[model samples]
Target: MNAQIAPPPAAAGWQAVIGLEIHAQLSTASKLFSGAPTAYGAEPNTQASLVDIALPGTLPVPNRAAIRKAIQFGLAIGAPIAPHSVFARKNYFYPDLPKGYQISQYELPVVGPGKLKVRVDDGRTIEVEIQRAHLEEDAGKSVHDAFHAETGIDLNRAGTPLLEIVSAPVMHSAAEAVAYMRTVHTLVRWLGICDGNMQEGSFRCDCNVSVRRSGTEQLGTRTEIKNVNSFRFVEKAIEYEIERQIRALENGEAIVQETRLYDPTRHQTRSMRSKESADDYRYFPDPDLPPLAIGAAEIERERSALPELPQARRERYIAVLGLPEADADQLCSDRATADYFEAVLAGVPGQAKLCANWVLGEVAAALNENAVEIAAAPVDAAALAQLLSRLREGVISGKIAKDVFAAMWAGEGSADVIIEARGLKQISDTGALATAIDAVLAEYAGQVADYRKGNDKLLQFFVGQVMKRTRGQANPQQLNELLKQKLAG
Candidate 1:
């Protein structure tokens, strides 16, 4: 499943090729082929059914919901869905595998070749091709520290449905691979197929890395970095592996094809075992389940039910709403954030940039400061929209609005209620501004004389004094105009 696309320029006469295999655990109530619960944090082996444990004479019936989710993912990426796909048994020996073989799709997969456009750190978009996305069952977990010198097996996760998404080896650096991984993670969550929780093992990535000389069309031997959970670790692991391979090659040593593990504590990768090829797995068609047949009607139904995807929403935010690409990308990073932005826009129509700034700036800072998500913020969308509406209406200055926002976040009250109680209304009246200007002129008579004598910068000093007098509620535009007029006289 290794292929190449046009990559970025080589680094120091060497080029690195990277691809990712993302395993997304499907969000279903039950296991793929059994009625066992798929909830996390259950007692050890508490949820494993007879079918999940592979009891003799227990036949598996494929869950229709899992199949439907796989189809949904295929349609989301504009990939063709196979009318007939088969499940095959991949033979392997592991302590966590209840059955001797894992049922997976090999020759005939549920999803065909697809592509995704990912934006890197430098704001350049790279189109990465996907080899395939197949359906499979997950193996149980092995707990090594649970017992004294004895490994414990947890079969609760066995028989869980997973969609393994394989990508072409077209990426040239760690940045590109991380960008592609993030794009897929956002997509599955947006499509409602997977929760995209890397910490909970709901979504994970396996990185395949190789390095070759600058001008050679021939590929180099590759290694697999197995089960990197977080985005930061993925980038670091690939970087270390690329350096390791290149250093080995330069020192007159051939790179070995093997699997490795990333140690976050040591920030290095160590050899896990020798890599296994497809032939080693001894794949064969599963006799327990028939060929999964998906009709055209099913495909159409899933396609019609899809919500407005992230890319489309991003484009609309940019072209129609006149937002910058960076703002749109940040807002559309997740579904809940985008929805909250839209809700604010709904309250105040025609203020796209303002809404984006508040969402990405102040609101974002508060969320990070309190370590809470947008959904759980103390100030919800409607309240924020109301606050923004007042600012739009010239009811309060930008500085005053921030103070109001702080109060609102503290569970005080609405913007209007707080503003009224504190008398923080903007001072835009000409008479009130003129009185403040006159008082400041009389107080700083020497500075006023210097200002008329061509010290134009003194104007700002007077403006600051006026703002202080008004308790930072002075309308900036009005204050400056009236101050300049009186100073000329």
Candidate 2:
């Protein structure tokens, strides 16, 4: 019980206080402040509404679907749904914002205070506290042509609803931040509130990276890494930022407060601009829209329908299914794969462990290498369950089961149909097995003599001969037992 865990990276004589601001675009049919379509990759400005394009007389309205989604996320994370949250004007003149200032939640957010349990690189769990998750409308894009002169503005993504999830400075290493991001990504996607596609710009992260001493409590100056497009890059960016900061501090140089970009090929973070403080935004209340006021009853309703989260489900799988902790954790890593695992294992008699093996070993491996989900897998759940039942019943050898699995993946028929069509039934009949063994013994009289002379290795030879004689149809246990009895006699 007193096992030593791997300690966090070198103390640097300074403490790193890490925090995260995650922007997850809510899944909805229309834009957040307009009736225009929120679809991606439209003809430039084609989906723009009067409000999105910010016509002189256009009035902004909140999207009801996006509001409900924000509530669902807060409830899922056990965060507070603020009864009173305001819309603020964050003033920054950029071409993407048709409105002079973008409307966002600043003074009071829709949700506040949640926590994420991240698995560190050393297999230890660290709780990354979340300060708040707020709702805000996204701005449009400014497209700069590499070869052309004019800077074009696309209002297609304008007024899109984005849930800004902010984390506290609790993460100590790049690995922990990456794990926390994955947990957040899965939670939003599983709840059907966000698409969680970083490449599609639906879910993105800005990590506040800093470094500190191993035992000190005081904080070090942190730099914010911006627009990390993928999970691998997130970790990479944090690592580079950490080393850069530590080097900067050690070399007697001031760590400038700044925003930075991660170069994927170069694997380093470059300074984007000198960081701007909150005061620099010139924050003011948005006069266009009123505050968000969702009641406790509405929050309670969303919480009631919230499905069991990933961590809770993982614990349940171990306790209910009698699986080892590692196996259960692996099985429940994703909601889709976990659901498929349950479908095949539930109600199957005396097969929980075996079913897990097939799932983790075969199904999961296939999915990972091919980069597909169980839902979209060529093999269906029922078909896989039936195949497992066949395996349990001794209708085919496990080797033959592999063949059956491959056949199904290649668009063959169901388990029974495949077995029948391919003549893959297991030979468990005692009489037929005995006949096959007798033939192997007679043909292999020399090997039989060796096995009888206490050359136990020859028994494997006899089993091989029996299988060859039966064309690999013998049930292994029955074959071994029958072979042993006749050989001993």
Candidate 3:
């Protein structure tokens, strides 16, 4: 929910508390409790099955694949897995909900409490406590169209699997909350549980915000902002709400407990409805489906088959590879980017920093320019490593290597072939570089004299002249040496 509110108090009396509820649409072939297809963009009710429509005598059967994915997510966050957990029916009325109740996990959830590290702006890590992650079935869509006098109901999304992750009210600012959301987003995608596509409504965030005086530990009245999809909106909505609460508290007004909708256009929030408590939903154990159970052997199997997680990958990039914190963080932000970086390292071992620079610098620019994902890039990691190797071997200067990269991007051959065809090889020959340096020194006698008279900054001037004379083909290190030798004379 994007909303506009008053600015936060500048004085020392106010502090904000924030928590998040994230729903990740599991990437399963069918719905959580039904055999209906979970594919998007299908016609309205085509994907709904008899079970999805809640026809008489149509009982739900649990999908084992979806449960295994939930287990994978719990294990990734180091959360305890319950051997047995039950599902409940949450009763609510909506036109799109044919069953008039949602089957979900309540008192007993599959995943227990967990913790994850979120990065702040100052390069420090803080732990966000996760309350629980529970499995639930999604409600269908109610589409309101301007062309139609009445609303439309779509049951395709109904019965789809979702993992609702709740977090403790531990964040103190908008930055921390946004960072936590991003960290969770990266994690779910990395674990292959969810696609993490906010635009398609695959992943969404609902934030709980409240404000209190700085010294008090007692909590304040909180409001729930429902389903703001983007990360920027999450930050903006919380910021506006915090300010609104602080201003209200300062004016001796009480905060109302309600559900609000964010207006991105107006930059403000409006009351959607009175917030519902747990009692309001009347959650009860569902009698139709039996309690789901997991064995130790299954948990062990999932653990052993786990892929390398984001935090461990970040640490390895830092401690073992000797990369800086920022570099490590950027490289490990996504699974595909990290895999690409590691592939480059495999091609050119022992050049970790160089590999990081190229990947984060030029390669990133190229990807952004072409509007292509790293996995779909025209240049692969081995090809990039080959180009960097030519630069490392003194076959081309860094300046010339860039042109060769452009040629490769244009679908030219390997770096060596491009270099040979374009006559772009570096001039590392001592005799040739020496003659060029001497000629430049003879022409720029005034500047050469200035350099001998202790104007050390003029060294760059002499190097520039030699580079110009050699048409930018001279090896920079060799030119620097030859310039010093001739100038000393």
Q: Estimate each model's TM-score.
A: 0.94, 0.95, 0.92
Stretches off by above 4 angstroms in model 2 are 1-7, 276-279, 347-350, 368-371
lDDT of 1 at 86: 99
Error of 3 at 157 (Å): 1.7
Q: What is the lDDT of residue 478 in candidate 3?
A: 86
Ten contiguous residues with the weakest lDDT in model 3? 1-10
Clash-forming residue pairs, model 2? 11-213, 14-212, 14-213, 15-212, 15-213, 16-211, 16-212, 18-169
| Model 1 C-alpha lDDT per residue in residues 1-489, reported as the tens digit of each score | 112444666777999999899999999999999999999999999999998888899988899999999998898888999999999999998889978999999999999999888887766788889999999999999999879988999999999999999999989999999999999999999888999999999999999999999888788999999999999999999999999999999999998899899999888999998765633988999998889999999999999998898988998999899999889999999999999999999998999999999999999999999999999999999999999999999889898999999999999999999999999999999899889989999999999999999999999999999999999889998899999999999
The TM-score between candidate 1 and the true structure equals 0.94
TM-score of 3: 0.92
lDDT, candidate 3, 4-23, per-residue tens: 23233333678899999999
lDDT of each: 0.92, 0.84, 0.89
Candidate 2 local lDDT, residue 385 = 93
* Candidate 1, lDDT over the whole model: 0.92
